[model samples]
Target: MIIVVDALNRHLFSDILAEMHALRARVFADRLGWEVTVKNGMEIDEFDALNPAHVICLDDDGDVVGCMRLLQTTGPHMLADVFYDILDGEPPLRSSRIWEATRFCVDTEKLKGRTTRNSISYVTSEVMIGAFEYARDAGVLDAVAVIDPVMNRVMQRSRNAPYDYLGTPKQMGKVKAMAALMDCSEERIAGIRDFAGINHDVFGSDDEVLSLFKENNGSAGNGSREITLESAYDFAPEPEAVRKPTRKDLREYCEAQVASAANDEEKVAALALKLELAEILRGDVQNRCDA
Candidate 1:
């Protein structure tokens, strides 16, 4: 399912937003080597402060598997502020009816190999559908996205190709970036729907969306299943606490971080943390045996 999170209701989806930012960190900063700011394992930029609407894709487990940030072009946006170089010296497009989409990414580590549902293809289409539809309903006439040639091809293959290009492609970091224009029309939405074989409404109700977070808060949440050094400190026990995390919990957290580390620095940090935790576990076991 998909959820459109805006500034008004963003408070309600804090957890989802966290996961989304983390996912962006993994994708852009870690995988793609984009020069993005990643703080505490979350990728955030100045545009994010503008309260742009986020179209998020949630898998059956209610995890934020995919997401995209949408900002109105009338104000400060990526195309205008950051990616103006892609405009080939032309002025950035500005209008109330046009929006800029960016930071489109998916959780490739989690949603891997599957052909449907949680697959990369599925979430990509789902995010696109949610983004375009949400913008269209809000009286947006078009959406401009900063994309690479690879993403452009993916958009073409998925029947959601941009109708036109605004400027020449320019090298940005590891890949070439260009401004692509896509209209928020029913025909384009229908084409994507047909290609993805998605017929039902993608938007989730407020009650339905909130219910998933309730489930997350009750359990250990995604924090337990996928742990990082940043999260390790966050989940640490209080000084006065009597109980500690189980051995299995510690092991899983360490192993997950080691496996999912985005870069060499992260991997080295995870390994060191894993070794430190392992030593503690060994000491606890030795004490129990001696007793």
Candidate 2:
């Protein structure tokens, strides 16, 4: 199958939208038996229209068989809203530094076993790389994702293990983990591509690909894995006094912000402000620690 990654645009928007709804219906409504609101067989929400997302297309006999949506941290995202209940506190949002990847669905009926690829692991990887490039071009620094442990394994393989365990892998229905991309490396990107089984020619040389990871990593070791739930608690600014934000708080904060934003600029600006607040809070908490 020839996998193509493209930003959703007017020309292909309707088709991709239909494809996404169909995939969601198959996976969520039909197969999983979850009650998902479908409009003319399309599963969509406010986020679909609010965030910049990419679609994965499988051109097998000139048809789009599989796809997923990616949301950057700068936008309203599942990590900050729907899945916030699983988190310890408000996740860092509105960072030119980080992005959230969300709403990943594939047309399982159309393409099976794509996730098991020894090289790519799943079709999501391509969308991920596409998202990474999209972020990089837009000057994004980090990528944050709440992933299943199995999918986490794929991410670990991609970055050559740049992250440490944030918290023990928490199960949300399935075994899910909260993960961050503190840094990305060439070796990591190559590994991810190799794992995804994507042609190296498309990504370019080890050095070129590595350059992309480096660019994304930002400020040298700034990209290196450092802050984790374990380490954060251990060397926090106020180890004894600080308390992690609860999932409820995070969710309310996100929902409130989303509801309040009157326009895209407002939403982006608000999220950026929140990210700044999160950084300040985290830093203040960290400064109190000995380490």
Candidate 3:
């Protein structure tokens, strides 16, 4: 599933962003041996501070398996700064519609056995499709990406081949890198969908997105795993479903929560207790009244 993080809503996706930066560090610095900066095992850069929109691909358990950074070419993008040498010294292409796509990485080894068309993994193609769709929807004309031969082949096989190339492929670590251009058009999106055999929307539903955040706050180091009743949002006294809280029960529950919490978390716990007790009352109103 694809989760978009832009300037306005970036704060709502802190956990995902942190995981994404970690994934980038692993894919770029450690795996690909790119000479990029890493702090606390996160590959965050200046452009990230620019608040560029990120198309983050999540696995079944909500872990970031793939991602690509999108930044306006008019700004401090790699093509205009870091990869300017690859432009062959003509001039860096700068335009509002032409965005620079960078930090395109995926968890290949982590998702090795994932099913996809053409015997390739799904995360890679899904990430590419999501990026183009995101750009196309946002009125982007085209995107210029720095990719290696391996990724180029993957794009070609997935039927989302780049329309043209820039200056040339330069030696970047053990791989050869080049700037490839692809349009953000209907035909390109359709071809990618066909190759991936995906006929429905590429993004996760609202419930899925909500579950992702809840899962993160409810668990540690287990993003992709599903939340069980025993672990997440469940402080029940028994296996049965919780009912609405009676007024007195809710008052006592709130009091207990406030008493147990010594810090600002008491306010949070009080609110949570009210909500939970409200559920208990909602479910057991008739039973409580009869008793």
Candidate 2 lowest-lDDT run of ten: 228-237
Two-way TM-score contest, 2 vs 3, winner? 3
The TM-score leader among the candidates is 1
Q: What lDDT tens digits, residue by residue, belong to model 2 across residues 155-200?
A: 5666545364333355565345565553434444556567677753
User: Which residue ranges in model 1 land beyond 4 Å of their true spot?
Assistant: 216-291
Report the lDDT tens digits of candidate 3 across residue range 139-215. 89899999889889988988889999999889876878899999999999888888777787878754686587557
State the displacement of the C-alpha of residue 246, model 1, in Å, after optimal TM-score superposition.
59
Residue range 206-239, candidate 1, lDDT tens digits: 7787677557554434454354433423442332
TM-score, one value per model: 0.75, 0.56, 0.72
RMSD of 3: 20.7
lDDT of each: 0.81, 0.51, 0.74
Which of the predicted structures, 2 or 3, would earn the higher lDDT when compared with the native? 3
What's the true lDDT of residue 151 in model 3? Answer: 82
